[model samples]
Target: MTAPSAIEVQDLVKTYAVRGRPPVRALDGVSFDAPSGAVLGLLGPNGAGKSTTLKILTTLTRPDAGSARVAGVDVVARPAEVRRRIGYVAQRPVTDPMDTGRENLVLAGRLQGLGARAARARADELLERFDLGAAADRLVRTYSGGMARKLDVAVGLAHRPEVLFLDEPTTGLDPHARAEMWAEIERMTHEERMTVVLTTHYLEEADRLAAHLVIVDHGRVVAGGAPSDLKDALRGDTVVVEVADDGATARAGEVASRVTGLREVTTDGRTVRARTSASSAVVLPALLAALDAADVGVASATLARPSLDDVYLSITGRAFEAGAAAETEEVAA
Candidate 1:
């Protein structure tokens, strides 16, 4: 028989009251299942309820409606038990700046009920595993951003919980630091066999780290599946043609549509786009010839396989960057 799901959320709803204004609906009918030993990404823009969902699952907040289970225990009914079985690393660093990394880890292990000797041993083990052994005795304030973040992850693992929740794990790291963190997380899941639920706004991060991805938008899940599967479902190569103006764009689309294998020919400003199952070489020449016959000036053209960005655009009818900006503005308001 298959092992039980490590995390499950069913039609979760949560609302927050605002002073002198209507309550905001943070989560609406959000649901997904994360199998054991899988890294599940909860992906979305700001204010998409990604954080809210994590809050509920981590037992930091109560859901207004629906049910959730983590490690086979109901969240609402036995929050303490659920908390015991999960490790949470928030978006911001939670390590005390004045404390040494070793101190923080030992304290965390102790709080989780490990004895003094056990906590010290666990702290040293994690320090070595996360490559913090060299600086383990240094104050957290002396650590670099990447080092501090790794320490945060180590603290979360101090108790060795069944499931780990990481909220925007690489949000503030530089590209290099982020890459290092990604490697660490990969080791955590694959080598250590830890189950993880990671919420992140970085599209590439989800594509790189998650075994399964759930894209949430405006308090609901818009799409979900393995990253490759979601992209494959779009089913063709994306051909983008850049033209001089609206007239050229329109003509380009008209010309592109005439190609036998091209589908969904459309125009956005000076850009003309279409999808085709044929190879780019097989379709490019015909498409270029058609545009040339129409006297449409081509600025540039590109052929790419379908990606997570394409899947998001197809389902949401908006680009990921645009949605992210909108969500940020909404949160500010």
Candidate 2:
């Protein structure tokens, strides 16, 4: 049997109006389906409608045109039901600074309609599981960034929601904390059997954690598939060969074109990057033979299987890390 969709969005649109200005469209004709018990990585740069999409799914905001359903509940017609079934962790901080970690989680549960006793019980369990038992009594303002973020996640899970929305969950975390959060997310998804929809500007994070991905750009999806499949779509492997100068670069391109089963040869004065089906059997050996025959000295050569980052660059014309940088600017402004 096929798995059911945890979240389904069709022709979603969100437009914001400002004084003395044309309305700004956040999400325009967006559509996708996420399977139950799967992690769908909704990736895009800043202002790419990622946050807008999450807001619609979590019932924080309503779409202007299209319909969205989370856990089989229509977002517009039954937003309350959708909210109850889905847990939302925003990209920004939402916990109260005056409240302790445990107190914050308990309050969130109560707000979600859990009884006092049940809320406290769930809070304790999550605090212990998230490795926050020792600091559960600490005030949120006094807690470290990582601890506070963990508490926010704990609050989202307090209601035992069926689908979770984590918007840039590790955005402000340090390396160690980020890794810990990733592991925690993986563990919780497995243990609770909940579907997760996460948005992130970090390609490495998406590559490592997501089982499937949908790459969005400027309010539209450009690519969607498993990471391996997307990477394989770039063709066999990438070979980066460094040569002497512009002349060597041109010669290398000519050589790569002559080499069988190779295409998309891009040169940058001293570096030549190309895609080839037979990296081991055909491309590499042919390039080496050509270089030798042309008397063009090769500084170095390296072959790497295509990565998710490569796919992003291929579709967007910019590096993934560059998009992260742009997102920083957007957030700051």
Candidate 3:
């Protein structure tokens, strides 16, 4: 028999009141299930309600409508119990700069209800497992960004919670550090068999790490499925034409749509983006010719395998980068 879900959210809605402005709806009927012992990634832009969803699941805030459960406990009615069963690693560091790495972990363990002696043992075990044993005695202020991030995650796991919540787990780390964290996260899930729900802005990261992915936009789930399944849904290739003149985008899109085999054609700024089931070998030439026929100047064009970015664009009509950069204040508000 299938095991019960680690998290279940149905029609969750949350609204935030911004002084001097209308109240912003941060969540609107958001719903998804994260199976036990798997990673569920909340993928979206800065203001797309990803963080709001995490807050509700972690019991940090109550939803205005709908319902949620974490580890079989109703979040609204049993928030304290939900908190006890989950570990939260926020986007910002939670470790104290004045304290050593080991100290931070021990304190977290103690607050989670471990005895003093057990807390130290758990801290030592985590320090070794994360390869931070060498630096466990050093003040957190002296550690690099990556080292500190690992410590933060370690602290969250100090209690061996059944489910872990990670908000933007690798937001500020360097490329090398980000990769390392990805591998570590993967290892922990496989070995610990714990449920992890992480919200992130990186398209590739979501594709690489999540067993199940949820795409949020404007406070709702636009699409969700296994990462590979979602990418495969848009069969064939993504065609991108970089129009030389910004003014020609409209003409490029209109003319490109008339071309055979092209679908989901849309324009963003000076670029015309679309998808086609035909192989690039047959479609690229026709696409360019169509643009040329419309007198649309093409700086360059590319055809690539459908990716998470393409999926997001196909569903949302906006590039991942544009969405992330467009508006960044909703979560903060």
Which candidate leads in lDDT?
3
Candidate 2: what lDDT? 0.83
Model 2 CA deviation exceeding 4 Å by range: 18-22, 240-262, 265-273, 277-301, 324-333
Residue 44 of model 1, lDDT score = 79
Note the residue pairs that clash in candidate 2: none
Best by TM-score: 3
Candidate 3 pairs with clashing backbones: none
Candidate 1 local lDDT, 93-139, one digit each (tens): 88999999999999999999999999999999999988899999999
lDDT of 3: 0.90
- Error at 92, model 1, angstroms: 0.8
Q: Which run of 10 residues does model 2 get worst, by summed lDDT?
A: 324-333
TM-score ranking of the models: 3, 1, 2
Instruction: Give the residue spans of candidate 3 off by over 4 A.
Output: 245-248, 292-297, 331-333
lDDT of 3 by residue, 1-333 (tens): 876799899999899988898889999899999989989998888889988888888877889999998999999998889889999999899999999999999999999999999999999999998889999999999999999999999988999999999988898999999998998889778988999998888888888889999899999999999999999888879898999998899989999888888888888888888888676788889989887887888999998889999988888888888989997767553
How large is the C-alpha RMSD of every model relative to the true structure?
Answer: 2.9, 3.6, 1.8
Please state the error at residue 114 of candidate 2 in Å: 1.3
Q: Return the TM-score for candidate 2, rounded to 2 decimals.
A: 0.85
RMSD of 1: 2.9
lDDT of each: 0.87, 0.83, 0.90
